[model samples]
Target: MLIDFLEFMISASNDSYIFLAGISAVIGAILPLSTIIFANFYEKSTVQTNDLYWELKREVNNSKAFIEGFNKIIYLGDNREIFNSTLKLFKLISYILILLWVLVGVGYIANVSKKPLDSFIISCSTLALISLLIYLPRILSRFQRELPIKVENKSCSINEIYNIFDVKGKGEDKLFYEEILVPTLSIVNTNSKLFIRYNQNLPLNNYKVFYSIQNKNKERLFINIGLLIKNKDFKNIHYTIGNEVSNTDTVQNKFSSIPFGIISKFNEIDSKNSFIYILDSLNQILYTGEVKCIFNSETKISKYTIKTYIDKSPNGHISKLLQNNEKEVHLLDDQQKLTPYYLLDYN
Candidate 1:
């Protein structure tokens, strides 16, 4: 069918030849323009940089081995060199094909004008151009893989806020509570200030902390606390846990600190204690810590302190799920240790 079409084009009258040349000229012009348009659209579709890229960029700059491996894999290595060479070759061939098509159209016009010498010179360009077009699809079929520049690792930490208070008996036997120091939660991040925010992938349902009050008889009272970290600018890295307004059912700004108070009966004995267990969305324990409460019977006061003591390292399933075979990227903080009350000292 292609051979018959070429023969028909060759045997056509001068006017018909000119018309065919006009069509080829339009196609020659449109091919590169269409390619440029598609390239622009694809560039716009893929975002060049994001937070993950910036984070990785900082780490890549600090590690010599990592930077060397990354560049070799993504940019400066043999794979990239070969791809770049192939890209240049195909672009050169496409340009030659386009120029040859223009020459052929000009030859047809020259033939119609009765200039055989110019017609022959232009017609000679056709053989190379036709051969290139026949093999164009094969060369153009190869695609390149772009190296990834982003990595995201989500982590959560649980810290306890300690608040101390003094209690005194009033003249009418009424008890008055005095705030000594407001309890504030301290979230520990050694290398980066990355904290989990409720708005991001960190959801309130993923974790819950429990507080309890136990008397001498071992009777216990329990309270549930939800995790909600909030801040005006997420980039600032300083975040505070949002306090739930009692009974109003509305979220409020962070209080002076995480505050809890206990009122014992005139001679009742009780010990207040709290502990937090960090969990993923699937309810798997990631970390657990204790919040100690010290009661002062002589001074009629109490002290509450929380410290994370242990972190359950990733199990086999979690490690396998987070691993990617295509690229070797560092995501785990293996050196990170769970400390008791680390956030309190982290000013």
Candidate 2:
């Protein structure tokens, strides 16, 4: 009976040991699984937070850059139309967002529950739209108020009408000083002979000059010439004109004869009655005047002269002439009474 009791105790102890080992194995598995779940949750939360921070930072940088570009445009007084249009577009988008917010709010209110996916989306969208509408227009309005400062900063203006003359090409054999000044003969028949001058104190770089003529039937003839007037070599822009056509032909073309080729295109569309226009690079007309064709029936030739009277001014004038038709404006030098100012002459 004692031996039987000893075996039973030993079996009970072994049974207890097995139970403890099972409990320890279960605890070991459960602890690692719990730790893994907690770690995953922590990592996901950290990644989401980092993403939100970066997105907010990027949005802030984009806003700052946009404001800077707008300010630069205002300061330069360039591309104002594009800037205004873009600002208006943003304002319109803000208004649209406000409308969307109102619609979403109505949807949320009509549905009594705020726990659905629809509720979450509507809430977030409404918040964002409300924020944009509250601030966009006031910012744009501030920029619009600064338009007067832009206009005040503009200093480029055509001061007066300078010189007007006709350019005539003599045969290669004709003497230089003996070049004839028969204005009546040159003006009536040739488009190659007319020249007009401008007295702009500004450089010719990025300046465009227009030549237009209207016939009796109301047909318009127009020519636009763009100049690259440099400050260092403004008086010697004949080289610039030559450079415009330098790529066309062989080296046989001389500098003095280059004007003829430049005027070749002008002569193709040339007219006796024409107008000269001065414009900024933006095609804004700074000044304009007429070239009148006076026909002499007895001589059977049209005598051409620069029309300076206000009544006879050409169609493209944005400003009036500082001097009248009778006054002569010299260019480059005061004593050099015969320098031709028209592009067709110098070219």
- lDDT of candidate 2 vs native? 0.37
Q: Which stretches of candidate 2 lie above 4 Å from their native place?
A: 1-75, 112-134, 145-347
Q: Pick the candidate with the highest lDDT.
A: 2
Residue range 152-219, candidate 2, lDDT tens digits:
12221212111111211122211111121111112222333333323222222345554454454333
**Residue 294 local lDDT, model 2:** 54
In angstroms, how far off is 285's CA in candidate 1? 16
Q: Model 1 over residues 150-268: C-alpha lDDT tens digits?
A: 11111212211100012111211111001111122222222223221112111112233333323444433223333323211111123322232234433322333232221242113
Q: In model 2, where is the ten-residue run with the lowest total lDDT?
A: 176-185
